[model samples]
Target: MSNDFYTSSILPYAAIIIKICRAYTNTQEDFEDYYQEVCLQIWRSNENFRGQSEWSTWIYRLTLNVCLTLLKKNSKHHVTSNHLPDVVAEDNRTFDDESLNHLYNAIKQLSEVDRAVILLYLEEKTYQEIAEIIGTNPNNIGVRVKRIKERLKKILDGKVN
Candidate 1:
């Protein structure tokens, strides 16, 4: 049943999971671990689907929540990894352009919440949709997006930490 569900539901939406997980993790091993964990949580919580939103929207909210929760939990116990990859997590195939690579690399440095906001914005989601997914007031999204973009610009220009 689970395998069937995965094939029918999750496989089709795997790219979103990969994008969210890759954004949340630094190393390839951590990316694999985060992806596995997000899939597990999605499976475990499948029964709670209330049909209140599009299946894709539910997946996005779940992916973001799982990534944020795991990031917070992991941050408390910091461990330096000698095997860390030189480049911060970017799916080379997805971002083949040199400039996109730099932009995405800069994105990875953003606060987790900002990264979530910008990711949704890049997906062309409306402020209302982003607010709904992130569980915030719609009015706040515009301001947050402006700030996030400015920060990304600074990061790209080597102007800010």
Candidate 2:
């Protein structure tokens, strides 16, 4: 992707990209990789935008799909090796609120679809918009969102693993 196109198409939506990438990744290295991959995929798929949906909506869908795909692939290739050095962040930054950190950790426990749903909900997307992005019935989004909230509460309360 050229610097000009990336600056025009992606930099404007960097926040959305960062939030989605953060939700899907555990470590800084993984986060950087996912962020790069998402940008690349968005650039590659730019030509496919048919204008049926708003640009933000298209970017959201593409971001979620790419994250989910990479997550599934990583899970299948689960590799553990003590010989590998541990990754450490060069910048030492921490969340100010423990509860917020816990909340995010809880959110990470959700199923991929539920995670996407909750993220969209947190972003204040309409149920219809979420359903359109997630390929679900609009009416079902409310029920799912309610259930997802309950699940998250349980996760935060140590009632669910």
Candidate 3:
């Protein structure tokens, strides 16, 4: 894509970029840094975009890879427990705004891969789409979503909190 196309067609989805950045960072400075980095990566890779998928899809995958690489290079403080149980107890549902905050917090408590899966799921991306972006099979994405949802419930129920 040309510079004009990128600025005009892709830059308009700034909110999507910000949301992706927020998923990858915990602070304003970190968020800004990741956001800028993702933008730069997108710009640098624009020439490699082969148009096999929707522009948004390509951007999403590229942005996620960029964030994952950066997170890998940084500290390991955000790594979620790998052995968290897949089963969760019932009767702990919180559907209010507090529930939303709890959801975000629980998301932060997940591992980087789990975080990416849950974030994309919460964003309402389909399993096939998520699989494409994450370079996994759709069936694997479905299974991971189920496991992550249970994990999130466990986190919200004070099991991991």
Assess each prediction's global lDDT (C-alpha) against the native: 0.81, 0.81, 0.75
Residue 51 of model 1 has an lDDT of: 97
Backbone clashes (count) for model 1? 0
lDDT by residue (tens digit), candidate 3, 65-118: 888888777756555443333332112222346666457656767787788888
For model 3, the superposed segments whose C-alpha errors exceed 4 Å read: 1-7, 76-99
RMSD over all Cα atoms, model 3:
6.5
lDDT of 1 by residue, 81-130 (tens): 42224454344333668887677677778878888889889888899999
Q: Report the poorest 10 consecutive residues by lDDT, candidate 3.
A: 85-94
lDDT at residue 152 of model 3 (Cα atoms): 85
Give TM per candidate: 0.87, 0.87, 0.79
Clashing pairs in 3: none
Q: Which pairs in model 1 have colliding backbones? A: none
Question: What is the lDDT for 74 in model 3?
Answer: 70
